[model samples]
Target: GGILDVLDCTFEGNSTNLGRAIYNEQGATVNVLDCSFDSHHSSNNKKGAAIRNHGNMTIKNSTFSGNQGARSGGAIYSEGGAMAIELSSFSGNQALFGGAIYATVSPSTMTIEATTFVGNTAAQHGGAITQLFSNLEVSGSTFKRNIAQAEYGGAIGVFDSELVVSDNVFVANKDKTGA
Candidate 1:
């Protein structure tokens, strides 16, 4: 098959570039189901230590934990196209920007529902999510204990973009913008 289906996979203890656990780019698509990405890191200017997307990706019933990005998108990053995430958990991830997730200039959109982001940190902005020139729809999500050390939007950043959030919880997040 031309599709990569990862079920009950565990990714942990990798370091180097961003998305130490997985990096999906150049219009590739990945479907992760009941998997775990944990305790990954990057060196300088690294991003998306757990998962990176420059394509169309989908994650369902997965967990991301303790990932770190030297630059941005500690747990996950998306650009260029659409990404769908559902019933997932992002916890204990850290980055210089978008500690948990980053969605940037894409031709399409991103959708996230029934997800949880907790104990993540961004040294600059958007402790949980940074949305730039893209479209995002989030429903039934929760963000807790996220931190932004420098700029703003502890939980989310909607910059020159369109975002729709419904039935979500933002709690105990630290940033200048206060999400």
Candidate 2:
């Protein structure tokens, strides 16, 4: 278990094999504020391109743009964790699943508020976000121009999860699997 707090940071063009930028393990608590992650990437495995959280994470007033993943979670992979994202934006990220965010594990939780996701793309599913067997709440968010090619959930995908969504705007999102 660990405690980390990062504030007012700018992470750009960072790359790794699996889960780069910040890797939060189980039982760890991390807080990120006023940060910007741009053009960060992950390769040679299916994981997070910018951050991977397996514990607890809170991100506020942040921006993620142009991040790429070899497989899943172009910006974040939150598995078996509690994550909260507020007043953040994700744009132009690409992945095979969850173009911007991927979260899983039952009993794990995630909340999003006042966020924006735009122009993210996935080759398979969840062009912006994906949650499987988790609890997720999203409100006051905007999703635009996200694309899921040959798949489903152009903006968000929830599979066997508990979800509450309200006051969100989705525009121009496309899932072109059978279209």
Candidate 3:
């Protein structure tokens, strides 16, 4: 109902129906610092293999790798509220939609800075990130070797959202639609 803080934690080989590593519900806030999430997996048709936020979340200096989500958001997912991510890394994540991160809901706001995403893959769109009806801003990040097996936006995909990207690097990303 309020706030939760996590620091210097390691989550390995976690499996769950949703939010294998962490889940923040509505009206709550979560702060994660210097954490590591590795080899997390969501159950069949579930979303958010590593972390899922429905309220407010801040992540700094975290690492997510080898996570798998059956539906979307292999590394992280935010459905509502505000989120801030900085100095984080995501690699080798896989999902049906967003391989690394997914943000949805009209009133949601997100900001990502100084992050790295590499070798992520998605079956549909947005091998790195996918947003829908949200306000998003990304800066000083790097995306490399990400792939979308079908559809467009190997690095990012937006649907009915306000997006702002600045000072980011994209390299060797592939998508079926050549985006």
Candidate 4:
């Protein structure tokens, strides 16, 4: 029922089991601009290291680096609503799934544009991003030197979802499963 805005801030070295940097719950809207999430680490099998969004969220011109999610979504985990991440960068993030981002649940939409993902790693799958049970559109992005260990999709992984990808660049991304 309310709108929250975070602008031009740096969130660094935050530690938590969930949403080490930011948490946006249902019925809320969040807009993040020109922010940076760095070294936000989860000590356990947590949901998100940087952000956990269950509602509407928009992040632009931001950066995420050295974040660690023990479970999934090292940079962002979005569900249950509309999400947009644009003109951003993610680097050196680690997770079991979606080292950079994980978007799930039904009726949710995510748009990513002009972003960059580099040197991210996932233990199971999706070294850069994992989209499940939702709609995703990514354009003009870059994925470089990312790795997925023991599974597939070193750059982007989508399962049972709608995906539209155009004009993106993927370089030196690999999965340990040889897939």
**Cα lDDT of model 1 by residue, 41-157, tens digit:** 877786677877777788999999888888778888777767899999999888888998888885758999999999989899898888888999999999998998888888886
TM of each candidate vs. truth:
0.93, 0.96, 0.97, 0.96
Clash list (residue pairs), candidate 1: 18-47, 19-48, 19-49, 20-49
**TM-score, model 2 to reference:** 0.96
Q: Going through the candidates in order, what is the number of backbone clashes in each? A: 4, 0, 0, 0
C-alpha root-mean-square deviation, each candidate: 1.6, 1.3, 0.9, 1.1
Best by lDDT: 2
Which segments of model 3 are wrong by more than 4 Å? Answer: none
Write down the RMSD of candidate 3 (Cα, Å): 0.9
Write the residue-wise lDDT of candidate 4 on 102-179 in tens digits: 999998899999999999998888989988899999999999988888788989878899999999999999998654
lDDT of 1 at 8: 94
Off by over 4 Å in 1: 177-179
What overall lDDT goes with each candidate model?
0.85, 0.92, 0.91, 0.90
* CA lDDT, candidate 1, residue 177: 60
Model 2 — which ten-residue stretch has the worst lDDT?
Answer: 170-179
lDDT tens digits, residues 83-106, model 3? 999999999999999999989997
lDDT of residue 84 for candidate 2: 99
lDDT of 2 by residue, 1-179 (tens): 98999999999998766648999999999999999999988988768899999999999999999999888899999999999999999999999999999999977899999999999998888999989999999999999999888688999988899989999999999898532
